[model samples]
Target: MSATVGSALAWWARTQPEQTAIVVDGESLDYQGYEAWSSRVAVHLRDAGIVPGDRVGLLAENSLPWSAMALGIIKAGAVLVPLNSRFKPAELRKVADDAGLARVIASDAVVAVAREAAGMGAPYEVTAFADVVGLRDAEPDPATDAFRVDREPTDPIAVLFTSGSTGRSKGVVLTNQSLLSIVFEASLTEEGFRQGSTSLLVLPLAFTPGLVWGVLMTTVLGGTIVIEKDLVPGRAVRLMEEHRVQAVFGVPLIFDAFSRTPEFAEADLSSLRTAIVGGAAVPVPLLEAYAAKGVTLRQIYGMTEAGGVATATLRHEAKDHPATCGYGSIFTELKIVDADGQEVGPDEEGEILIKGPGVTPGYWGDPETTAEVITADGWLRSGDIGRKDADGRIAFADRLKDLIITGGINVSPIEIERVLMGLDGVAEVSVIPAKDEKFGETPAAIITPSSPDLTAADVVAHCEQQLSDYKVPRYVVLREDPLPRLPSGKIAKPQIKQDYADVHVDFDKVR
Candidate 1:
């Protein structure tokens, strides 16, 4: 069987040609309709001298055209570089140049940013939506039975750039086999396709979890996908009711917003079966709340380098193990190893390492850095600390780089954040290490309150009851807005640390 993503997409198109494949806003496109448009886009790309293995940068928000363009690029056998639309002009330019892009497909909203990046004469051609989809009212190309080049399982499909704690972004190179492995694994475990299953695409497709698993997985399984440009709570509720969406994937923050919407309570969300929550730790209370609504909230834990998802709490286990990150997927092999590379026993916390078909080959153009993380034996050091229970369920601890060392004790920030998030009036919280002369470092809590009446002292007192004396925040900083987040919906901890470091305080005075 061919393992290429294009092959899977083609198979779905052939089997369900007239079935609805994508619905965006009010527009709908069936498999045949989408395939025809994708073919025309591929022909245009081929005519422009783009060849197999060439990188094509796609800069757009969640829209129908972006999905069409992605499929078109894959059919043309080119690597798709889905640049984050939130990136600034300079950041976009750096990614385009680094990937050695031959062409870029920019949406109307991002055309100006694309132009600014292309002005540097980076040897790449740029095309806006008007140039491709709106040019000359072109007719869709027929599905030609021409000779096509076969793709290996290892052929590069996409390059996802993820931010590092050291203030640099690393490009994780995903292949067709790796991406397909994740899609297949998710399908097998999640019961993704019943009869008329519909999935809502709320997260940005530029991110790995969204683009690779969220969108592409639905396509491969011949399921309908509802794409939304913005994640307004009202719009999400209306779309769910309008389309009878059965499954959805989102981060914790998105879930919170959806739950708080008045429309959510009134709308007919009974069609929703499974809601996969990840990107950040899911508060225990949030998990229980969603479960009360007849939606099974599965906690997924993975990173870009691992393709999409490594572990996910199964629907059956969602109610009991709401805090557990769950077991590894079918194709994924996860182990907790100590610093010396010895595998730790069950229930022991250690660095998480994964080895499987779902793991990416390595980072793009960074052999040294890649070698540092991906061992010679093919294990990718996840940089995350976790422990596996006897039942094979994995529970997340903290990122190795983000672990707080204070008073000769290593504290997992995730633990503190989870506890703090349960406090009354707290909307969001992030724990970081602050400079402390006595303990070398102390845990500091940066909190954003849902109400104006919340004060730093109130939060400190709340933590004093639950957390150990030392684990509680030595310093508290209240913010009016939520913390900065990455495109993946994970908190930008590096930026948070920097922001908190700028605050000068007397540790002795607080004590």
Candidate 2:
């Protein structure tokens, strides 16, 4: 068998038939069981007229079936489009139309939302997740090899939509070769990403970090993945102890929340060997919090364009340069460049560029936008400002895109400002990131209202109806004076950011 994703699962089933592959909410699925389950789903999809190169939409919370369904789509040689569960109807409709989905598999919890979203887009078939996963008696005939399609290494396996800084979502097309390359390389270099290791996965599978690092990489290593739909702090600690989880991948907020749990003091975290934090800068207190529990919190840095992980701080190097994102991964190369596209010397702040096999080819159906970010020679403009030390370690400085990462989810300030600008009472609005001790950063709206009666409360209420829960402004500021502007007639965000540099949100009252 080839080194494609579907082949890896088949290989594992044949090699370790009874080995546990996944544990979801106390339910376990062995290698053979998972392979058979996914194969069955592929058969059903082929029966429903799905073929190679077709795009399939998966809308569901994290669950055992969701994992199987993801692999099943790959087995059937179709592209999997994982939709965010937090998306409202309009958002979903946009994604549905953009991906030109042929069929959508939705869980019972979000089936109604899927219907409403699909109703607004081009007509497509919607199947309940239960109906597809429950095809135990409808096995495919062995003569046709269960209708499994063979995929080449370069065949697109999944199209992940990353929320752009410009408020438009871009679908990044990822190939089987790209995903498998990262999986194999990281297994050798990334500590705790080893065979038989158990990892606690709390991030939603829809996101890049969760799907790539938590699922694909773990599966390729024949490791066990413990999926948690929601992050109940106490339950997460208990689950880690119960599963003897060796690896935990999440953002700073997750570790911060875990430290505050009552079980933190007496929790048996002895099993934890690799705890990696990303999505935001890891606070020193958060690293010390995990350190006290006998776990080291290593930092990782990457984006959806880099296939989830481009650089990671290894165990041996974590203590020396605790703040850096460490050296590039096995197959990744990193460089910092100035505005003139010239490589800067060590310790110089510039835009980070990545070149590697795991790097995305380009955005789906948007060649012009793709050319803007990725150079012709294959280097990707990360849009993140950072500096590389003499030792080749990368330290994050700031974002050129001005994206706000709240609770591990990327929020575009432009997206929120567009929504707020729709309000009749709002004349001009500028959204900036508010410092939060709990969530790292949250959206804060600073507005110069047209009407004197336009209050912060009204702004929040208007946003509640348009944006997702995490995208809503946690801190609102109403100013009587006009916001500072630049010569180009754009909002002077740098000046505004400096003005509110000390502004912090009380998460207890807002959340």
Instruction: Give the poorly placed runs of model 2, Cα more than 4 Å off.
Output: 136-147, 164-166, 403-511
- Residue-wise C-alpha lDDT for candidate 2, range 1-511, written one tens digit per residue: 3878778787787899899888888888888777777888887789999999899988998888888888888888899999887677788888888888998889999988888888886877888987976754354445333335778888789999974433457999889889987777777775577877889988888878767877787778888999887888899999899889999887665787899999887899999978988765666666778788888889988888998778888777776676799878777999999999999999987999999989998888889989999999999999888899998899876577688998888787767886887787876778899888789899988889989898777888889999898999988888889887532123667778878776673322243
> What RMSD does each model have against the real structure?
2.3, 10.7
Q: Which candidate wins on TM-score?
A: 1
Candidate 1 lDDT over residue span 109-153, tens digit each = 988888888887576788898877753245544444221334677
Candidate 2, position 366, lDDT: 88
Worst 10 residues of 2 by lDDT: 502-511
lDDT of 1 at 27: 82
